[model samples]
Each structure stands twice: as C-alpha cells, then as structure tokens.
Target chain A: MVERRMPSIRTTRFSALAPLALVAALLLGAPMLRGIGAVQAADGGNTIESVAIDTPDQVRITFRGEFPAAQATAENFRFAEAAAPDAPMALKSVKAEGRVVTLTATQALHPTERYKLEVADPPISRDVTPSPWATLVTLFLSSALINNFVFTRYLGLCIFFGVSKKRDAAVGMGVTFTAVMIFTAMTSWAVDTFALQPLHLGFLQVLVFIGTVAAVVQFLDTMLRKTHPALHRSFGVYLMLITTNCIILAVPLLNAQGKVSMLEALVLALGSGLGFALALFLMSCAREKMELARVPKAFEGLPIAFALAGLFALAFMGFSGLDFFR
Target chain B: MSETTERPPGALQLLFNGIVSENPVFRLALSLCPAVAVTTTVANGFILGVAVLAVQVLSSLTVAIARGVIHPRVRIPVYTIIIAVWVSAIDMALAAFVPALYAQVGLYIKLIVAFAIIISRLEVFASRQPLVPSFWDAVGMGLGFMIALMVIGALREVLGAGSFFGIVLFKTKPLLFFALPAGGFFSIALLMAFFNALERKLTGGTAKPAAGGHHG
Candidate 1:
C-alpha cells in the first residue's frame, strides 16, 4: 500500500491546463519585434512606451516615465529594419519634447515594412504625447499578454491540464476555444452595451455570459451535428467543453464594465485564444517527453503537470518587464 | 444483506468528510485551478475560499429547495443558472465593498461559475437530498474546501516568503519555488500525501488516491 503508482500521462485524452501564455507573449511580442528597439529597452525607468510613425519622415517616441527632452541627442535613438542590427536607419534630426522624442528620418520608410526603433539605455523621461490610437491600441494589446487568462489569471486550468497531453488535440481544442471566445466575446459585448448597461442590470453579467456561452455551444453543436457530422464527431466534445472553460467566461466578465470597446474585446479574445493554444502545444510537447522518463509515483499525474505549469509560468515571468511598446 | 446497508453520515460527518476523506482539492481532485492560483498567499487563498464557500452553500440550498421543480432534461442549465446568480451577486458585492480583495480574486469569483465542485455537489447531493441535509452537506464541503485551501496557502506562504500570514517566522532565505504556481503544484501534492498518511493513521482506509483526478 505504501508503494506509489503513476497516473497515466500518456493518454491522448486532453491537456490539463492552457500554457499559450508564452504563445500570447510571442503573438503580442510579434508587434514588439517590429519595434525590437523598444523590446530591448528594459524596465529600469528607461523603457519606451509608445512609438508612432505618422509619416515615414517623422516618428514620435513616448516614454512611460520621465525622460529629459533636452538630453535627446541624435545618437540616443537609432532606427533599424526587421531589427537586423547591422543595417541602421540614419536619422536626419532629433527633437525632444519632455517625454516625447520626434525623429525625422533621412530616408523614407517602406509603409509595409515593420520598423524597429531602438532606444539606447539611459534614464528615459516620461514625455506625454496625445496619441489616442497608441493608448487605445496598447490597452487592448496588453490584455492579450499581461492579462491573459491562462498564464496571468490562471483560467481554463482544467482543460489546460486535461487536454494538453497530445499536441494535435491541444491545438484542435485551442482553436475551437479561440473561435468560441471571439464569438462569445462579441455577443456578450453587444448584450452588455445594449441591454445590461441601459437597464443597470450589470449584476446579471455572470448569468448573461454563461447563458451566451451555453447557447452558443448548443447552437454550434446542433449545427455541426446536422451540417458536418464527421467534423462534429471529431471536435464536437471540445466545442461543448469550451462552455465550461473559465478563460472564455473570464474574458467577457473582464470586459463587462464596458471598459474595453467591442474591437478590443475581439482582439483580446483572439490573442488569449492563441496564447492558450500556444501554452497547450508547449505543454503537450513537454508531457510527451515525460513519457520517456520515469516519474515518481506520488508526484505523478496532475501534481507533476502542475509543477511543470508553475515552471512554465515562471519562465513566462521572464517577459514580466516587457510591456506593449517597451 | 444487513452488512451491506451503510449508515449515512450526520451533518458534522459531512463537514468532516470535506476536510479529509473527500477533500475537493486533495481527494476528489476537483476545481484545482483556483486552489493553485489563489494559494500564492494565505490572504489570497482565504478570501477566494470564503467566496467559493459562500457561493456553494447558497447555491446548494437553492438547488435543494428547487430540486423537485427543475426539469431533469434541462437540469444542467437550471443548476448553472442558480450557481451563476449566486456567484455574480458575490462578484458584484466584492467589487463594490471590498475593491482591493475583489481586484485580487474577482476573476476567480467569476470563474466559479465553471467550477465542477459547486456544480457537482448540486447535481450529486443537493438535487436529491432534503434542504436541511443539503445545506449541511454544502457547509461541510465548503469548510473542507476552505480548510484545504488555507492549509495549502499557509504552507506556500511560509516556505515561499519565510512568513506565515504575512508574519516572518524565521530569518532563513525562503524557497522561491513555493511561491510560484509550480510551488502550488508541489505543495498540493506533498500535502495530499501527508494528509492521506494522517487520515490512514486515524481511519482504517477509504482513501482515494492523491489528486483523484476528475476531468471536465
């Protein structure tokens, strides 16, 4: 009786929880690579928060903290392409307005190309620029990264831990979860905006969001069963299960206060979905590797998987200092 | 035939059951995410546990009282609606009165709508039992869950931060891993084993394995 037995981890059943937080970090970080210059600006009060390329000729840099406008020299900020580092874009003039630094490029930038705006490590001053677009965009963008349900909020844990045993299944479940999230997010936003807000029945959000999710899942289930039986048989269980995933419910609830616009809701859902999928894939791959190793009897099954998730979260913490543009 | 009929446990027994025998975290292995996420600190875990326990008791009582009227065919939805109502009410109140606590556990409170533990009790016991019995059942289960969470939280806080309930216990450097989510996993596992060992020493043996994993 004292001898321990390992809970089976090889069953292609499902991942236990979502890990796409890194995937979210990556997806959100994609925009960062384009501004790889700001990505490298570590969190020592020297970080750059926002950069605007209104015209390729002139770019505006906004700092989250204080940066002296007078100290802004031409060499302080170097612009680059695809972040090749070797090939730097020459600047025509450097102008600083408190925390806002405006750089005029010597050459016109390709409109389609993503530019990497590098800032040298120094005390960055908080310059205020009124780019409503940047502020709105980053607010929406960071939710996908910092506010992600799985990594940050720890939602969708049951599915993440259960279904992540197989990479393909995890990917499938993640995609289905993301699709449901986008639709549910949009529908919930509409309901909150039109019905709940005017009536002051904000407390009904949990019921409203859960109802929306359940109704969506049931509708999708019926439509799939009738229209595409084969596909339904393949992924229908996953579709139905998304209704129970906390991440999906959490998304709408977080946006229930009408703090984010409808577009931001959609973006956050998509980013969160992708992040969840990424975490699932990473976890499945790692769990698959566990098959070859001998695990202790006591720490087998959910225990070890959770331990791994903790490690995954810690690793994601490496990106803690990384903010939207910074 | 006479030996097969088991005597049902009393109200206190039901509550005691949640603490050890059928601990939602350690034994039943249900609703683990909140257990892991909120256990980073003792205060965090206790607050979440309180929220969940309150929701569970109210929802269970409601379910027990409404059991006869709910259609079996659509029972799942009805139960869901009941739980969601209670959870939402708590969610709103927390945000309004205890903004700081709400800021920390609001997501968890909202997410309680999806917890298998609360819904499972409604389905398994409350729906079939009398109102008084169901209420006791839920209270027992709630206390069990709260106790389990606090035990995990206290352990994590002490080992991770070298403190207990925010008080420093020693001068040693704390183990950082205990504070991380991984620490949550490890702490839960070891604690499960420890709890099981203690349970065995007391009661003869009816222990389910540690992390009696139940999939959604």
Candidate 2:
C-alpha cells in the first residue's frame, strides 16, 4: 500500500510540472522546428491565402483579412532555400499594408532553386491569442537563455566579474541578485502600470525606474541587515552596488519598454536573474580552476576571464534565433 | 585621481590621463557592459559615445555647480538624478531628431543612467572640483570612453562583418566570429591584453594584473 501510494504521489508531482517540461522540450526543438513547414493555423480562415514571387528579391504574401502591420515585421517571416535549407534568406526589408506583406531579400532570390516561406508569428498574432502561460514561458526562456543578460546582452559585468572570482561568493551574490531583481521588477511594474503609464509621463521612465531600483535596493539592504544578519554580511555591500547594476536597471526598463503583463514581468525578471546567476557560477568555477594554471603576464586576471567568457558566449550562441513555440 | 600637490592638474594633463593612463575601457574598466554592448558597430558605438560624452559633461557641470548645496549623505542620489535628467534629454533628442540611430541605441541611451563611468566621475571628480576643472575632467573621461569604443567598434566591424562604418571592405567577412556577441568579448579581451602589453612596454613598469577587475 505504501509503495503504491508513493508512485501515485510521484505521478501527481510529475503532472504538476508537466507543462514546464513540455516548454523546455519545445524550446530545445526550436532549431529543428525552423526547418519544418508552416504550423497550420488553428482557424483555417487565417491561413496564407496566396504566396507569389513577384521579383527575384521580393516575395508577396497575402492573408485572408487585413494582416496587422504590427505582425508583419522581418522577424515574423522565415525564408529557406531549396539548395541550402539550413541557410535563412537575408531580408533587406519587409513592407506590410492591407492584406499583403512584401519581403525583399538582400540579394536576388535564385530563379532556379525552390524556396519556402513561413509566417512564423502573424497568424498567431491575429487569430490565436497566445495564452498567458505560453507568453510567460516564452518570455522566461527567451530572457534566460536565448537573450541572456550577461552573455548575449552583456549587462551587469561589474558585479559579474567582481564576485564571480570565488564559488561561494558567486552563489551568494547570485541568490541575493535574483531576490533583489524579482522584488525590484515587481515594484517597477506596479509603478509603471499604475502611476507612470496612466499619467502619460512616459518621459519619466528612466528617472522613475532608476529611482525605484535605488529605493528598493536601499530598503532591501536595511531589511536584510536587520533580519538576516549572516546573509547580509555575506552579500550586504552587493546590495548597494545593485543600484548601478545594468542588469538590475535593464530588467525594469525592459519590462516597461515591452509593456509586459505583471506575471510576464515576474517571469522575465526571474529568468534574467537566473541566467546571470548561471553565467556567474560557470565563470567562477572556471576562474577557480584557472588560478592554478599557468598564465601569461598580460592576460593574468580579467583578460583570461574574458577569453573564457568569449568561449561561453560562443556556446550560448546556439540558442540564438531559435523559435521556441510554433 | 590621487593628487601629489594641493593644486589640481592642468587641463592637458587631465585629458592625457583620461585618454592614456586612466582610459575608462582599457584602464579603469568601468561600464564594461555598455561598452561591449554598443561597440558591435562603429556607427552605433560612435552614437553611444557621443551620448555618453554629452551626459558626462552635462552631469558633471550640474554636479559641480550644485556641489555646495548637495549634502554628502545624499550626494549619490543627487548625482544619479542629475545623470538621469541628462540621459533622458539626450534620449529624447536622439529619438526626435535622429530616429534611425535612436532606434538602434534607444535602450542603451536610457541605460546610461546606471553606467559606472558617469557616476564614478561625478563622485570622484565633479562633486569635489570647481566648475571649469569638472568640465575638463568630464571631457577627458568622455573622450577616453568615445575613443575606446570607436576602436573596439572599428576592429569588430572590420573583422566580424567585413565593413568599416557600414562601408564594405572585404568581399566576405574576415572572421564572422568577430561580429557575434561572442566576438565582442574576444575583441575586448584581445584589445585589453594588447593595451596591457603596450602600457608595460612604454612605462617600463612591472606587468599589472588586470585593472578592469577593480570596477563594480
């Protein structure tokens, strides 16, 4: 009876996390999914009505209804060549008006080779509203890996380099950073949604966001010093440093700029914080090992560390330009 | 920034120090994040460089003029507010006048508020100094930043994209790796190492462990 009950509990836990696992699996499949044919529209009415090759460099796509211009940017369309399916066509410009989107390639499309056009986003943008879960998951994963703040975007290097020298410090700083990032992101989102946006004071975004982050960091510093003295001692100074941290500032600014929902904002913050933490941890481990190795005089400390980061950035590049959800 | 005498250094000396000895990117290692992010292209880097220069000068001027009134306890916040104001003005100007360049660097323009270089200069130099010296220091630091970024941007663009300031140089990219985000790291690392070697050669001093590590 105990064994049977244990299996039942395990299965229940698995079911609870099933969506998250599915999202990861889908994210991993993005590169492969890029080569696959167009995802059939949920509502057949919204499917591509016609695709005409107007010129060597231009492909005109028409939809059933007025294709929202917002949904017709270059990123929404993917083009593949028959000769080299893996190589995406380089688009010079994309113009959308009424029901038409005209894509102009940088070079003339080969007259002989067949080509495939996939409208990766617009159909969903128009017809099937992305569920909140999907939006949240996409933002989270994209921020964490595909568009990693530290590796790809290069935000927060001062703390990233300063604390990542030691494993223990890295872990401590990473935790403090994530907690602070989430709290700050939440506060900024609230201020943005309630105070700033309604007032038509968009110009105040930089001032307000920085002020909010600074206020939050100060509040956290005091609160931690009192409540968690041990933890404060470990990473207390880092709290003050968090004010000028590009990552800390970037998250709230990004959230405001994107006009993301609150939950989506939270997920973005969590993801970016985790991504930065991951970068720090990996660099610390590598740096710790490098301390023992022989090094040239010029590339002793930061130079070698940056070299290591360059390699890591190369590895992270695999995640770029991936389409997570069809 | 330690002064040997009670008197401040001359303007030329200050400018020389910023451009060579205490270059923000290669020497001080301040604001490395934004430096690398915007240096992907010469044009982008130049635009950001100009923006940073303007902010640094404006903020420094503001801080120096108002330093007498600003309390020591709240100087950091005051400096920040001043920086944010200048950055927002630049951001708005770029968006209004040069919308194309603004589109590329709009996010980074807003990000200048948090840059360690501008804030550090304000704290270390501007807040303590008189208006003229502060102005010169800001220019020196700003010029150093701009030059460093332009150098990195030119190298990256030439190597990565086979272009210099959007003018195609090579028929094909010399090394596509130089254009990617990874390439940004490598470019800075290589240039930093090279600068270190050059400095050591010129100064006849013992090799110094990376100064970039001290920031943030």
Candidate 3:
C-alpha cells in the first residue's frame, strides 16, 4: 500500500515549497503590477482646486472642501455659470475629502465654459453643535436597512453563514454584529479622520480596523461574561467570532471612504446590520425547512446551503427595481 | 517505531481529499458566505478563490506549527490574531495594488479572517498533522472551495447576466432572479441535489453516510 511508503525528504520539501512559490509568483505577477499602476493613476490629481466651465451648449463646475457640518444644506453652497447664474447646473454628486468638497455638475461644460463655487457660510462648528444628532438617525436607517451592508453591499458574509445555523443564534449574532459594527465604525472613523487622514497614516487603516474590532469584541465578551452571565453564555462564543467578522472591520473603512459624517456612519452601520439580520433570518428559516427536504447525499449540508443562499440572493435582487431613492 | 510507522496520509491523498472527498464548501460545508456572495461572476469567484486559498494555506501552516507552544485556553484567540494579521496584510496589499478587483471584492477580502474554512482546517486537520501533510490538506481543501465557488459563480453569472467573468457568453436577457438572493438559494439547492445524485451514482449507490448525519 502507498501508506507503507516513507515519503522522501525531497518530496516533503518540494510539497511545502510549491505553495509558497506559487504565492510568491502571484504576488509579483504582471497583472498585480499593472493593477498597482492603475491605482496610483486613479488616486492621482489635484488636492484642492475648483474648476468651472460655462459654454453656450453646457455649463458645469467642480470643487473640493472639508467635511460638511451636520446642518450644512445643499442650498447653502452656491454655483454660478456664464449662461445663467441663478439657474446654475444642478448638483450631480458631492464627494468630500476632510474640509474639501468636490461637487460635480450634471451637465457638461461648454467649450468656453466657466463657473464659480462658494461655501456661502462656514458649517456649524462641531463643538457648538450637537454633532448632528439627526444625522445619526439618518445614517442608522440608511446603513441598517436602505444601504444594508450584507444584502446590499455584501460585506462580512463569511460570518453571516457561519453563525446563522439557528434562527435564535442568527438573531443573536446579528445583534452582536450590529453593536460591534457601530462601535468599530465610530472608533475607526475618528482615528481615520483625525489621525490617519491628517498625519498620512492611511496605510494603518487595515491594521487599526482589525485591531479595533479584535479589541472591541474582546472587551464586549469580557464585559458580558462578567455582567450578564446568561446572556454571555448564549452569545459569548459568537462574540469572539466577531473579531474576524469582516463587516465589523470593513464598514468603518468604507464609511471613511464615503467620507460620511458620524451620523451618516451610524445610519450606514444600522442599515448594514439590519440587512445582515434580514439575510440571516431568511437563511435560517429556509434552512429549517431545508433540513427535511430530501437533499442528495453529497449535497447534504453546506452545498445545499449554498444553493439555498443563491435563491435568496435572487430574491433580494428584487429590491434593485426599487427606484424610490437613487 | 509504532508512531513513526503511523505516518499520516500522503500528499496525493491529502490533495484528493480537498478536491472531492472533504471539500471545504460542498463536502464539509465550511465557508459558504463568501462562496455565495462572491460567486456573482467567474472572475470574482476566481479571485476570491485565490485570496481564500492564500489565507487558508498560510493560516493553516502557521497554526499547525504553533499548536504545540500555544496554550489551549488562549489558542482560539491566538489563532484569530494570527489570521487577522495575515488578512490585514492581504487587504492592504490588494487595496494598494489591485484597486479594481479590490473594489469589486471590497470588504469580502477583509472578511477572509472570519472564514470558517481556515479555522476548521486548522483545528481539525492541520493541528494534528505534520507540516507536509498539513500543507497538502490545506491545498486540497482550498482547491475544493475554489471549485465550488467557480461552479456557483459560473452558473449565476451565465444564467443571471448572460456573461462569464464579465464577458458576454450569450445575448439572451438574463433571468434577473438568477442574479439575486432568491436565485442564490435556488441555485445552491438544485446544485446540491445534483451533487447528491452524482455522489450516489459515483459510489454505485452506496456512498458512506454523511458525517454527523443530520436527516434534515
């Protein structure tokens, strides 16, 4: 039998080295190098300058500013074009970087187009204002339901399936995930906006987010174990699991990318959390019935689960037709 | 001499185990979340497979080597931290290097740390086995997972979008459902049924009962 064979040292070394060599090759591969170039080009360009174009055929303008305050309204920022100052081009997208705002116009600018953008007034100071309490509500609703992390963006799914074996467990995991997501998002947002973005520590986002998530999950586990023993017993095991959950770590990083306000981040977190809950809940319900369905011997468990999830994904796609919000 | 004589399985056996017998996604049922989420496109599926393969292989190797020194009580957390470090490294490298694929995969890359496949293999196989055997097992398992993802992704992409890896394979309008949550569920179900049938036929109608045989 092959079992009686003593594997040669050369074979052992070759087997181990094979994968490492493959990984090295992939890392240094040509596609990866080209991709890096593209990223650099994409991130390249002006940091803080505004451009306005006003032509007979079209009018457009673009500018950047710091993070918008809570009460900062679209109406406050004004734009004027050579064609019509009062009827300036409509705002297309508002992308912000710290205090610099990059506003794009819907219509293209004419050949000799020129336009102007002004802040009109400084946003309410963060210290003076209540940190846009309403923004938090909006952010929560948007992130938790509307722009859900799991169903919508499909982040942190590895954990979604792992902890969602039972309905109760799924709900418990969802709650824990939401709590951790909000906590991590907020903390990372602060660190990114304050420390990383300011001091060029952007490279630290991944390290910081992962560290924060691991730390937060640990803290929560310890606190729950000490304070609510029964609750901990139910959710404790799943708590440690959250440290590796991508949604908890990824949402904050994404939130920072979108340059969302604190309130907006909360809404994003809530929406994502609810989305995950929705997906897991539906999955658990389906799996419950799936337990009895005469699945093939090979497709008995996880394979069937994956197929079932495919169906669920199909159903969730129905929401794509919802045009209530762009 | 008894222990030395009891050498664990060979490399070929380990490799075959991952490909067919104990497939991470289909056979063992580990790491289904990314399997479902990233299978929207063949390219996505392929890239995800590579990412997961790298993480699983490295994490498994690391865990296997340190299994003896790490205390049992703190083992889980230690395993997680190690996995997280690799995941973070991968995440940053991808973001910095391949922004397009990075954007498409997005948070799914970071979530590799939480994938049960890596932890499952680490605990069940890698921890007990020697380094060479552990490495082969990881490869086999990783290949199994990649195959599963590709199958689902190809089906979804072809039927849902009339494309494979973004290339237009057909001009027909896609069955929009095939691309959505409902489609994901239905596809897995049908595929599972098919796989079961295949297994039954392949084994001459006498495959061994599934592990932890749940009737459901």
TM-score (chain A only) for the predictions, listed in order:
0.62, 0.62, 0.58
Candidates 1 and 3 compared by lDDT, better number: 1
Give one digit per residue, the lDDT tens place, for model 3 in A114-206. Answer: 344444454211101111322343344455444555565555555655656788778667666666777877787888788888899765666
Tens digit of per-residue lDDT, candidate 2, span B1-216: 243246777899889988878999888888888778888889999999999999999999999899889998998889889999999999999899889988988888899998889989999998788888889899999999999999999999998888999999979637888878889998988999898888788878575755755453
Question: What proportion of the real contacts between chains A and B does each prediction keep?
Answer: 0.51, 0.74, 0.43
Report fnat, model 2: 0.74
Tell me how far the alpha carbon of residue A306 in candidate 1 is from the true structure, in angstroms, after superposition: 1.4
* Candidate 2 Cα errors over 4 Å, as ranges: A1-127, A321-324, B1-5, B205-207, B214-216
Cand. 2 TM to true fold? 0.77
Displacement of the residue A48 alpha carbon in candidate 3, Å: 29
DockQ (model 2, Cα)? 0.52
Candidate 1 lDDT by residue in tens digits, A259-295: 6777777777777776687778788999999878886
Instruction: Highest TM-score: give the candidate number.
Output: 2
Cα lDDT tens digits for candidate 2, A23-137? 4775565434322222244566566665545435776766778878887788888777755556778888999899878899887753223565667764432211223444555
Q: Per-residue lDDT tens digits of candidate 1, residues B107-175?
A: 788888999899999988888777777888898888888888889999999999988878889988999
The DockQ values of the predictions, listed in order, are 0.49, 0.52, 0.26
lDDT of 3 by residue, B21-103 (tens): 88766566566567667777888888888888887888889987887788878876677677777777777877787788888
How far is each candidate from the true structure, as Cα RMSD in Å?
11.1, 10.5, 16.6
Give the C-alpha miss distance for residue B81 in model 1, angstroms: 1.1
